[model samples]
Target chain A: QKEVEQDPGPLSVPEGAIVSLNCTYSNSAFQYFMWYRQYSRKGPELLMYTYSSGNKEDGRFTAQVDKSSKYISLFIRDSQPSDSATYLCAMRGNSGTYKYIFGTGTRLKVLA
Target chain B: EPEVTQTPSHQVTQMGQEVILRCVPISNHLYFYWYRQILGQKVEFLVSFYNNEISEKSEIFDDQFSVERPDGSNFTLKIRSTKLEDSAMYFCASREVGTGANEQYFGPGTRLTVT
Candidate 1:
């Protein structure tokens, strides 16, 4: 199985709607999970990061990790057209190595 | 706010030619990384550097790929012999130690086209 898996969603939502992006992983050793936003042809911009399990909130974005399930999620509240971009889920182990495994990003389009 | 920066945003080269992609990471960052994304694919880790040495590298980072911190401010990735399959967007990222170490700041990226 792929180490990390994410739905390659071209998920469209209306402005002011809630958007949820998720990823699943098979590596139980992964301890740090991150969410990045990438515009077309641009690099991945760090949005949210969380260590271990539980929830972390920053402004309109929230990140949740369920270690037992090996699932991670990024929730965007009051989504805007500015949030239209690809969302990438990345994670690394606590083994002192900085190598990150990434999932196929989900494309999001927020209509105005 | 300081950010990572890369030069030659777009490069086109013939197969078998060598090409070096350059990046200037955030000045205070201690860790540097190189990653590549093929069109419509996930970003794949190439290598990570710290203290002027490679700390870790993925399997995809083979004999043809090399990374260097040639100077205090500049880090570079060199593909010794480019192949058509090498065409992709390469991103440079850096992370600082201590607080917020998990956050990696990425550069805009260099699009390499091998023909």
Candidate 2:
């Protein structure tokens, strides 16, 4: 099984709607969970990061990690057209080697 | 506000040619990594370097692939012989520490197209 698995969603929603992006992993050793945003033809940009389990909120974005279930999620409240982009979930173990495993990104489109 | 920077934003080369993608990581960062993303595919890890040596590498980082931090500030990924399947967006990333708490900063990326 892949270390990380995410739905390759082209999820479309109207402006002001809430968006939820999620990923699951098979490795319980993963301690660092990250969400990245990528635009077409550009590199992925780090958006949110969390360590271990629990919820982290930054502005309109919230990242939640459920280590027990091996699940992670990024929630975007009041989504906007500018928020349209691909979302990638990445994870790494606590080995201190800084090696990361990434999931296939989910493409999102927020329509105005 | 420091960030990683990559050169030759885009490159096109014929199969069997050698290609070198360059990067300048954050000055104070201690760890470096190379990753690649094929069109519409997941971003795959290639290799990680520390103390001028490879600390770890993924299966994708085969014999044909090499990474070097020849100078203090510059890091590079070189493919000995490019193949058509080698075309992808390559990203360079760096972190101030190797711990899990340290966040990695990524470069804009170098898009390589092998014909």
Candidate 1 collision pairs: none
User: Docking quality tier of candidate 2?
Assistant: high
What ranges in model 1 sit over 4 Å off?
Answer: none
| Alpha-carbon runs more than 4 Å astray in model 2 | B98-101
Task: Give the Å error, residue A64, model 2.
Answer: 0.5
Clashing residue pairs for model 2: none
lDDT of 1 at B42: 96
DockQ of each: 0.85, 0.83
Which model scores highest in lDDT? 1
TM-score to native of every candidate shown: 0.98, 0.97
User: Candidate 1, after superposition: displacement of residue B51 in Å?
Assistant: 0.9
CA shift of A94, model 2, Å:
0.4
| Model 1 C-alpha lDDT per residue in residues A1-112, reported as the tens digit of each score | 9999999989999999999999999999999999999999999999988999999999999999999999999999999999999999999987664678999999999999
B1-115 in candidate 2: lDDT tens per residue? Answer: 8889999999999999999999999999989999999998999999999988999998889999999988889999999999999999999999887344468888999999999
